[model samples]
Target: MVSCVALLGGSYDPVHAGHVALAALFADLLQPDQLRIVPAGDPWQKAPLQADAADRVAMLALAFEAARLPIVIDRQEIERHGPSYTIDTLKNVRATLGPGASLVFLMGADQLMQLDSWRDWHALFDYAHLGVAARPGYSLAAASLPPAVAAEITVRQGSLEQLRTTPSGRIYLAETLAVDISATQIRAALRDDDQASLAACSLIPPVVLDYIQQHHLYKN
Candidate 1:
């Protein structure tokens, strides 16, 4: 059997339950040899992160330490300088896994819609297969996809079997548990200490919450 590695990259300013749940779901679905949870070092497309790189990585480690899942907190993107681009990260991960290993790039449905805007977005398929998780109100079959992306989807889309076996060039849509949580909301709640907001932050793990409180993160 070919070894498969799934890469799920994000700012992970403070890894929350939604992130952990999605990672677990994907791991079960793909049965990859490893599921790497990557923290973005410097995301150019978005506003600057509230927490520092070390802090984000530390929280990620705490969040996944007892996940009972085959997950690893990958710090390559966190360690690298400058903006963190998906294509660049994929290239490095692909090379590390070699040509024989199947590399799966995991993303949410919303990210798929905006993929064309990413730097060298088209080249992403050349390095790894896309494993997109369905999000609320986002339809993978919608007509909003870019022509090139839609074309690639039509041709390269595959079943879980193909996704597990093929080394690259496939798009797999997975229905994962929608936790309806966002890091932005969590940060806002932590900063404001609003009762309602704090309640909504239940999606965050206890250990991670403790770490956040200990470090006084998001309390600007």
Candidate 2:
């Protein structure tokens, strides 16, 4: 059987339950040999991150402590200079894993909607297969996606087994994921007058909440 590695990359500003759920859901379905959590160092398209690299990485560790699969915290993007791009990350990962390993890059449907804006977006499939999870408001319907992204995914859609077995160039969509929390909302809540409101929301893990509080993070 081909070895499969699932990569979940994000800023992980505070590492919330939604992020953990996405990884857990895919881990159960793909049963990949390894799962890597990649925290972005400098996301080119987004505003500055509220939490620094170390804090974000630390939060990710705390959030994913209960994960069943072996988890790796990849800091290549953090160590790399300049803006972080998914294509560059995938190229480096592919080089490390060689040609036969199945590399699945996971993301939400919202990201898929803006897929065309990513640097070298079309070439991403050359290095890894995409495993996209559908969020609450985002639609996976052909009419809901950009023409290019919709056309590309239309032909590459495959089963969970195919995602686990294929080396690259396939798309697997998981439509049952109901997670809808956003890091922006979590950060805003952390900065609010009532910090307890964030805890009540249950958007982030308890351990992560502890870390944020202890670190005095996200205070403006």
Candidate 3:
């Protein structure tokens, strides 16, 4: 069987249950040899992160502690100095994995729609297969994407079998259970001392929530 590595990159400012659930879902669907959760060091496209990198990493470790599969906390992007571009990260991972190992780059349906705007987005397929997770009410069909992305989708889309066997140049859409949770809302709840909101959402892991309270994070 071909060795496979799945990459799921995000800020993970304070890794929540939703993130954990998504990782677990992908692990079951892809069955990669390793699933790496990469935290962004400096995400150029988004606002500045609220928590420090070390704190985020620590929370991620705790959040994924009970995961069914062994999930790795890849700190390469967090340790790097400049902006964290997906293409650069993918290239580095590809080089480390060599040519034979299959690489899967995981993303949400929202990211898929905005993929054309990413830096060197077209070349991403060269290094890893795109595994887009379906989000609630978001369409993964090619017709719904931008012209360039639709064209690529039409040509590079592949089945689960091809994704499992081939090393690269395939786009696979995996259906996942809808977990309507966001780090933004979690942070806001922390800031506002809204236990009701947090409990209602039920997205933050207990350990992670304890860490956040211990560190007094996201109280801005």
Candidate 4:
């Protein structure tokens, strides 16, 4: 069987339950030889990150500590200054793992909707297969995606097995993810200490929540 490595990348400003769930879901399905969590250094598209890189990495460590899959916190993007781009990261990983290794880069459906806007988005397929997780209200249908992105995913969509066997250029859509959580909302709740909203959602991991409070994060 071909060796596979699954990568989950995000700002992970405070690593919440949804991030863990998305990673866990793919880990269960792909069962890749290795799982890596990539925290973005500077996400050009988003606002300035609330948590610093060290804090974000610390939170990721705590969040995925209990996960069943072996996890590696990849700091390539964080180490490289300037805007973090997926295509660049993918290229670096592909070079390190070599051509024979099957690499699947995971993302949420919301990211898929804006796929066309990423730098050299089309070249992403040249480096690794995409494993996108769908949440409530996010559709994988072509009509929901940008015309260019839809065209690519439409013809490249494949089963989990095929994604595992293929080296690159495949798309796997996993709709099993039902939790729809966002980092922006989590940050807002933390900033306000809105316990009621946080409790109602129950999407932030206790350990992560504790870490955030202990470090006095997002209290601006």
Candidate 5:
């Protein structure tokens, strides 16, 4: 039987270390039958990502190749002509997984803070469970939040074992994985030919680093 899975969606704008770290940690905690890495084609909430869909997918595939974990490159939104809503992505995964499969939609703390602003945010809960990752130096307190976000939460706690039973998308506190890295910093370093910044950056997966060197990405 195919198992319930967790869905991690993003632009993967450049598929940085933070993205990979979340994938690794969540895979460990959820122990999903499978973990789908769905990269958005054109995210509506955020600006259009710098990397194209094909490149982003290739980079992610390379980054996760060592583990051989089942990472599906879901392109439902990429195919669509308009904005990519989380609800749409969730709906597609729900259909693929069926009713028995428990799906979790993963997001960072920043996304959760603006959860109320998402289109049909409440409806998304019907499709999958949620895994809200902690941002660097972020606290997951629900106090002072709008009732919609606060009451709807299924806060997570306890050991990895408890994670499976926890409500979806409830705040899941995690140590900063892959360190504090940003796509912008990586791009800047690439532009300036700054070896120190590139070396210090926690953004690139080693394989991705090699790929960047070979392809000379971001050379303007």
Candidate 6:
């Protein structure tokens, strides 16, 4: 049997409740040994992140508390120069875990569809298995993809045992709790009041909200 590791990396500019909720769900469903909230530094493939690594790392520490599952704020990517490629991160994690350690990278359904666009994406499957997050209105069939990559994906029913001793480098669709909150709306609220919902409609936690207030984020 192999020790399972769940890697959840992102540019947590202002870690919100959505992130917190997802982490908890991932821990509960997959029950991995560690849930890593990797703060992305200079990602090579995408545009520069919104906030600096330090700020994002700080916010992540603040968002995650003892109440949440054991989520480690891994800094490997933050310390690395150049792009924060998933493949690089996976390799580092796999090396640390040694052989038989199942590396599972967690992501939302929307991001899963775009996996083919990532740098050395095909190789990522070689390094780690995938945990496709389940969200409302997120259809696996509708996730537009290249025929070749699409054929390679495997959708699971999101069971804890199913993931316990599964094959390496396979994709698992984790059907756990889903919080449909968008950060764009949160940012827009700072500039102009949200027309669709109230200010508290944001999934961001109060502490993050307070920090953003203190720092005057999203303000010109």
User: What residue pairs clash in candidate 6, if any at all?
Assistant: 44-83
Worst 10 residues of 4 by lDDT: 193-202
> Candidate 3: TM-score?
0.94
Cα lDDT tens digits, model 4, 1-220, are: 3389999999998788889898889889998988888999999999999899999999999988998967899999999989999999999988988898889999999999999899999999999999999988889888988999988987898888987877899999888898888888888777665568667336788888888889998889
Tell how far residue 217 is off in model 4, in angstroms.
0.8
Tally clashing residue pairs in candidate 4.
0
lDDT of 6 by residue, 1-220 (tens): 3488777887775577777777777787777777777878776655566666777777787788654456678899889877788888888887877867767788887677677888888788777777777766665653455665577773333345645565356777666656676666666676665556446535677777777778767664
Residue-level lDDT of model 3, residues 1-220, one tens digit each, is 3388888899887787767777777788878888888999999888899999889999988888876766788889988889999999999888888988888888888789899999999999999999888778778887887889889888998987788788899998777557667788888888775568657335788888889889989889
Error of 2 at 33 (Å): 0.8
lDDT of each: 0.84, 0.90, 0.84, 0.88, 0.71, 0.71
Q: Compared with the true structure, what per-residue lDDT tens digits does model 5 show for residues 111-158?
A: 777889999887776666667677765455767456678777644334
Question: Considering summed lDDT, which 10 consecutive residues are worst modelled in model 6?
Answer: 154-163
RMSD of 4: 1.5
Q: Name the candidate that leads on TM-score.
A: 2
Q: If both were scored by TM-score, which would come out higher, candidate 1 or candidate 2?
A: 2
* Leading candidate by lDDT: 2
Better of 1 and 5 by TM-score: 1
TM-score of 2: 0.96
Instruction: Supply the global lDDT for candidate 5.
Output: 0.71
On residues 54-152, what C-alpha lDDT tens digit does candidate 1 reach at each position? 888888888888756577777888888889998898888888778878889988888888888999987888899999888777777747677777887
Which 10 successive residues of model 3 have the least lDDT summed?
193-202
**Candidate that beats the other on lDDT, 4 or 5, i.e. the better one:** 4
